[model samples]
Target: MPNVTIYTTMMCPYCFRAKKLLTQKGVKFDEIDVGTDPGLRREMTTRSNGGQTVPQIFIGKRHVGGCDELFALEARGELDAALQAA
Candidate 1:
């Protein structure tokens, strides 16, 4: 499995949903709480190419976007492959 990193805020439902999906898939992810840190938020924005939202997810080095995009990948049957990628 590849390294999964998710930038999340404490109270975001989308973030919780995204994490639940990943957990269901048996994927261990690095969760970064950016709720109180402006620097971390800035880092997330820079990494995501200006995505200023909760649950900015990355599988390995590839950006998988937010909760909706993550579910879209699952619906498309590409999420497993992405997770398994090197």
Candidate 2:
């Protein structure tokens, strides 16, 4: 399994949905709560290339954007390939 990291915040429905999808895919991820951490939030934003959203997800070292983008990948049948890619 590849390394999965998700920068999220509490009370964000999109974050919950993103995590749910990952869970359903049997993927373990490192969740970083940026609810109260300014520095971490900045980090997430920088990592996401100006994406200041609640759920900035990274599969290994690849930035996968937010919930909609993630589901889009799944819909296109590209999410599994991304998850399994080296």
lDDT: worst 10-residue window of model 2: 1-10
Model 2, CA-based lDDT: 0.94
Which runs in model 1 stand beyond 4 Å of their true positions?
none
- Tens digits of per-residue lDDT for model 2 on 1-86? 68999999999999999999999999999999999999999999988999998799999999999999999999999999999998
Total clashing pairs for each candidate: 0, 0
TM-score of each: 0.99, 0.97
Q: Which candidate tops TM-score?
A: 1
Q: Write the per-residue lDDT of candidate 1 for residues 1-86, one digit (tens) a residue.
A: 89999999999999999999999999999999999999999999999999999899999999989999999999999999999998
What are the Cα lDDT values of the candidates? 0.97, 0.94
